[model samples]
Target: MNEKEIQTEIESRVQKKLSDLFTTYKTDTDSLQAILKWKPVVLMIGNYSSGKSTFINELLGQDLQRTGQAPTDDSFTIITSDGSGEGLIPGSTLVSDEKLPFTYFKDFGEQFISHFRLKKVDVPFLENMAIIDSPGMLDTVTEKDRGYDYMRVLGEFAKLADLVVLMFDPHKAGTIKETYTAIRDTLPESSGEDRIVFVMSRIDECDSVSDLVRSFGTLCWNLSQMTGRKDIPRIFLTFSEAMAANPESYSEWKEERNQLKQKIQSAPEFRINHILQDIDRQVNEIKLIAEAMNAVARKGRAKLGNTAKFGFAVSLFVFFFLGVILKGMTGFPEQTFLAALLGGTVQMHHFFVPACGVAGTLLVTSLLFTKWTFPRLRQKARNSLGNLITLETDYRKNLWSKVENRVNELLKNMRISEIWFEHQTNLGKIVKFLNKDLQEFYERIRKIK
Candidate 1:
């Protein structure tokens, strides 16, 4: 299949899965919708003056993004093709635009709004894919300075991106705290390593071949510390195409630059894997929640059983004591009391009235147990829910803990006994989709050229 065909199929599968998820989970599917609203994104992140904008301009063959020696651009720009006449759209308007996928970005407040933009240039390359140019990372800045969570915003983009370009230059060499924190803490642990492509941009800055080698080694050491990976990932060495005139030390890495460009062009092919991996992770999270709900349901039913046993026993005792009171006061149904005594003489005809009285008393006791005693016990259990979650494995316990609030919410709206059955049924449906339907779609994409 071609890139367009692959993208169409992925969207179709994700839509089907999301429909099932919405029906089963009974929550907002806004997050899922956001991912599909935009085309495949290749997010570019790096320290200041890493020539990220330069590389982007060279690829597009147009200077749409601002570039300089020092942080020339502070805004996070979403560059794409504009069918409605090429222009720059402000963030305030962009968030409100339904056609765009950045509505959720409004939560970052006016500070971020002031710093975000959409650069819609009429480029042929953008017709196939989109590029996100992040604000240049600096060692001195904090989340407070931006009046919003910068790394968090970037992380959201990272989650949405099919490929992430983490670029560096000889000057910084992977020493920035912002870069380290992003690698270590922001992106999803399992898939981030595979999705991210490291780039040593501005390779011409190196004084000699030996100098570039030193910079490469430094980046490797820093990456090992940040990612905790024993083996180094492939880092693309590239410089701006404009630097083609007598690059003293950069002459050796020209082939590497061409290879990097080729890799970037092939980014659309990687989208198939990213889409599948994202779906897998989301389904697994739901599975954990289902298992936890099942656990809570089981615990609740057992407690109800115990309560019924104890409550009914006490009710029976009360009925017996009341019968004795009535017999002493008015000698009502006197035959039952004497017959119940082992030494009393038997009178079958006289036993009829007492038998009728015992039946009525037991009926009243059963009603009280069902209405008041059972409900009260369930209420108490609801308040102390921690005692009810019986899980065997540490992984299950951890997953349950993360989704504990969701379980509590479900229980609050309905009986725990009902939840277990519903969750079990939903889990069966989800597992089948993941194992069979989702697998078929993924295999088709993998088989694509």
Candidate 2:
């Protein structure tokens, strides 16, 4: 067979395997259908205030996403093809219900509140692509939660992307290494290395044009080498603020941005189409695993049932034998005649005594062993199976966690936001005080390429 034919065969086999696995779980066929009908989802991820929301707005040629100086605590804004985007807010249902032009986070005080809104302009982008604005990685929240959010979004993004665009800011003195590592780590293993793209934003903030170009070039090279995609296109640079605030100052940047847009527009529409194939593969795998688990459970239940049946049969035999013995043991005239006719010295009174003893012993044994011992054993087996399930869940969670940590470590070095200290007591001061070594560590990353 030819190379293309071989690839098709392999994909078909994999898909069949996944479908077989998933079938045991009783998952709906339609659930897999949604995944198959994947759209190109672009996730804008970076540190808080790294111009992610702003850049998204600029890309759609409108202020669809909320942009401000305040730190956005909530991370996810899902813009889909339906002329709407949903923001998953933390506390209030109202925030979740309100429709805004784009999703954004605004400061509420010591507690960072999350809000979701909808916008119209992002709808067109969503027709072919789902634009996701993620929460900033370096917010003051717990690293675990941030990591979780990042990994979740990354997984979703991976499923949707024909290409991934990694956005960065260069004016800040920090490393791009961490960001690059995050992008690399979060990418799905199923995706070949050629699908990711890098973009450096806020180029207008750089000291000089040469510095911007040099930094961007170095970042592109380092990222390419690290990710083992040396042949991928160079990182694209843009002055997003200039594009937003004063379009005239950076016409070149604007042009570059447009070219990137063209690239996206012109790229092959295979990713979404390929997702249908992947869904088939995953379904089969899920079905297979579920079937195996079900088989084990059924076997265990059947074994216990058989043991119970055997005990019941033994009890009935003892009861009948005891009645026969009792009749022979009785010294009554009628009983003696019956015993004589049977040609046996059946002791009417004694017969029952020994038979009952045997019956009682058997009953005790069966009750003790089957009712108590066997039940405990069966319970242990069930528990073992349950533990296995738990372990499997934990294993998947750990794998996802590792991926998230790698991504977060990369984001920390990107210097996506600044800590303003107008008042004597700002949270940034506290962060700086605690993370001295970590900050230095990230600073070193800035010089890598």
Candidate 3:
């Protein structure tokens, strides 16, 4: 099947299998909607004069975005093709259109929307995908300077991007404060490491090969410190063909530039994997929650069984012996029922009154357990929800953290009797979807051209 057909099937299957669970757990579906509605997106972010726009322009083979030594643009521009002709779409319109996946940007307010735009071009490269070029990161800028939370906005875009290109130039060597913050704190939480492609752009600007080596070393060191990894990630060394001063000297690096461009062009292919992983992650979260609730249900059943057994035993003893105890204490009864039975003169008719007493006692006990004892058990369970499931792995722990509050809320508000059957069914559905349906989808995607 084609990309659109696969996407449609994914959406249909997710809605069928997990929509109710998402609503119950309060999992946000906006990112899923964004992925479904939009073409594959490549988000570019980097320090000022890091050659992000220059690199994009080179990829498109057009001088679309302004290029300069300093920061030339301070807007978030989405470049795509419209097929009708080249044109521009205002950010206000972009955020308001229901057909587009950008309605969530309305939360960023009008100030950010004013700085956001969509640039339509009649380029073949944009026909299958879209590219988002962000305002360059700066050391001196604060949230107040931008009149918006830039890191938050960037993170949101990162969550939706199929591939993220983090461009760095030799001049900065990956030391810009905002870039450091983004690499350290933002992208890790928003985008997966596999989705990010690190690039050392504008390497031709170095005076010599030794200078380039030194810059590359500095970048590697800074990235190690920022990403907290002992081993270095792959950093593509690239320089724009049109901007190279010593063209022959950097001729060997042209292939690197072309490879980076090819990587960006492969975003559409990556989008399917991203969608599948996203669905898998979300379903796994729900599965963990189901397992937690199942644990709670099991504990509830055990407690109820023990309590009922104890109550029944006490009631049975009272049925046979309560009349004799009352006669001994009050000194007003005739021969007690147990005494008469022991004398071998008791009749079936003589047992009817005590039977009535036992029935009353059992009914009262059940009411007390329902109205008082069960509620206290539920409260205790709710308070110690962390003990419900054993998080054996870091991945399970991560999933638990996402749904911990939801589980807490469920225990607080939902009855234990109501939790067991439904959540068990939900768990089965999630497991089946993940193991069978999702695996089949992956196989189908692998067959795609």
Model 1, position 262: C-alpha lDDT score: 72
lDDT of 1 by residue, 1-449 (tens): 57567667767866666567655555444545666676777898888788888888888888788888887888899888855558888999988987767888898889999988988888866776779898778764444576777777877777677788888888886445466565434333345577888898887777777987898888888888766678999989888757645564466677887887677777777776776666665665577666655665555566557655765675555434544666678887665444465556655655554455556656665565456654665565557666655666544454455456765665556543463477777777778877887777767766774
Where does model 1 exceed 4 Å of error?
1-20, 23-26, 83-85, 171-192, 207-211, 241-246, 311-333, 337-408, 417-420
Model 3: ten consecutive residues of lowest lDDT:
183-192
RMSD of each: 4.8, 17.5, 3.8
Q: Per-residue lDDT tens digits of candidate 3, residues 284-354?
A: 77888888777777666676777779778878888778887777889634766787788998887658657
Question: What's the count of clashing pairs in each model shown?
Answer: 0, 38, 0
Alpha-carbon deviation at 412 in model 3, angstroms: 2.6
| Best candidate (score: lDDT) | 3
Rank order (by lDDT, best first)? 3, 1, 2
Query: lDDT value for candidate 2?
Result: 0.48
- Each model's TM-score, in the order given? 0.79, 0.47, 0.83
TM-score, candidate number 2: 0.47
